[model samples]
Target: MTNKKKTTIKDIASVLNISAAAVSKALHNDSRISDKTKIAVRQVAKNLNYQPNHLASALRSGKSNLVGVIVPKTNSNFFSSVIENIEQVLNKEGYNIIITQSNESFKKECDSIDTLLFTQVDGIIASMANETTDLVYFKKIKKNGIPLILFDRGENNLNVDYVGIDDYASSSLIVEHLVNQGCKRIAHIGGYKRTRIFNNRIRGYVDALNKFNLPLDKELLIESSLTIEDGRAKMQQLLALKNKPDAVYVAGDYAALGAQQVLLENNIKIPQEIALVGFGNEPFTAMLTPSISSINQHSDEIGKKAAEAFLVHAKNSSFTQTLNKIILNAELIIRDSSNKKNQ
Candidate 1:
């Protein structure tokens, strides 16, 4: 004969000869219940294996306590750190997380948003895909009364909570550092500037050169797909130029890695014949043959601020009425790659 299924609250109450409410109160440690009765009820519940249904309770309370988060690129270290931090904060606040990566596709991003909404998420946090221009697609979240928090790479025109660093200032900082390194003729390898972050960096690069009275050489400015292979091609094209750059500023380290590899293949000296600086101080930067100098994106703090913003919106009933942007500060990380002394 098969054993019967585990007992429910009703079974516990029946065995104890008391009301289901009494058993529940006793299990929840209600002060109204006498100490003797609470002990007896708890013992009976333990014996009968009564379990409260949290999902049913949440449904009755009109709260799922679930947050949906979407990111464009997840392979990078910065994204990994941001997700871990968001998880830490959400877990502490007794909320659950649903994570999805869009891989920089608008269609996939939209589909992910739909799935999250279908799952009854209370709120959403997202980093827009590089190719995403249809901000109105996310208007459904607002229509459903869900607060959307956008972080890192996001839109300024949209009405949503945003947390990120001032990429413009950070870009300027890196440019100034390159200038101070005695590189008068500097070239920039630009990433996909359609995204807010890359565009800000490109602007910063141009502004710095103009401020320094250095002409923006069209030949020296190279556009990259932000991949190693693409960066290698950009570097090769630059090397063929009549006047090669003394210093090159790359937007992403993954591209820089490809460029560095090409430079070695061509016997191009780093920081000697050509200095290199990159954004996103990735872990591999420090371990490379010549450590890459880069802008510290403050990814950990960005995640922390995102968590704080989520808490603010989730806890405050008037959050929808109040809108504010939180921008974090970033600094330059000097390493062997950009140091003239390294050679």
Candidate 2:
């Protein structure tokens, strides 16, 4: 069997009876090309299944028109939705995006940044991993003159463009709602304090508890990666306490789901026995047996804003402009899990 030759711009040009330069201009939709020629070039290019040599174009123009996105995990609704929206915005601007996951590992996150830089991506938008404490890798991106934007898990210390919801206020909203449900003793299952968003949530949880005059029980507060397994382990620890909490507020939906599973396995009724609330308003949270109350982080808006931030940096030659920090408000979504009075 003979291997078929890949179609190129010259092939499309030959088929269309036009010069290779004309084909290139037509493909790029150059203003110099007539509309009739542009339409014919595109149709013939499509018929020939022509693919542009992006690498060659990048070498000539010094702009790859490619963006890189790094996230902790893509399986979650929040990250997936954010990625989808980012793609939507970037695609319209003639830019393609490469998504990489760090799996919440700092070493992997550093590797991803290196890979993106090696690929010569125009810019990078990322959410830092849980274990990422050092900003040296991110600083390298800036040193190399690459536009860097962060979302969800961002740091003010980096002084880069950021788009995310106000986590501390979201936590306060959760505490207020749980208090309204008459939960006297509330437990918090949150992410590690090293992460900015989680630390803000923890602070908000403590301050909110103080605002309500509730006793601060150190035993009821646990810090982990907020994964499903960690959620189960933390919930189990809370259950073993001498005075168990009447309500639990987990900083992640996956963790909340794990806590709910543990409660159901132990035959403890939700809301009636102990209320539950989660963050990130994941789709499955509503589909669960006892739908969990959660905070909607506005994933779509966050994604769009993050993409726009990249565009801003990409267009500006001087990176000296004031950094854009967009903070969206999170909404408290009440559901069966924490709606004891309503249920």
My TM-score estimates for the predictions, one after another, are 0.91, 0.92
Estimate, for each residue in 104-132, the C-alpha lDDT of model 2 and write its tens digit.
89999999999999999999999998889
Which lDDT tens digits does candidate 1 get at residues 1-343?
6987757777888888999889878887899999998998888877777777667767977778888989987889989899889889898998888999999899999999999999888888889887787787678877888888889778557777888888888878877888888888899898777777788888988999999888899887877877888889898988999988998899889989888888889998888888898888888988998888987888888887887788887888566723568888888888888898656
lDDT of each: 0.84, 0.92
Worst 10 residues of 1 by lDDT: 316-325
Top-TM-score candidate index: 2
lDDT score of residue 162 within candidate 1: 86
The runs of at least 3 residues in candidate 1 whose Cα sits more than 4 Å from the true structure, single-residue gaps closed, are 1-18, 22-51, 321-323
lDDT for 115 in candidate 1 is 96
What overall lDDT, based on C-alpha atoms, would model 1 receive against the true structure?
0.84
Clashing pairs in 1: none
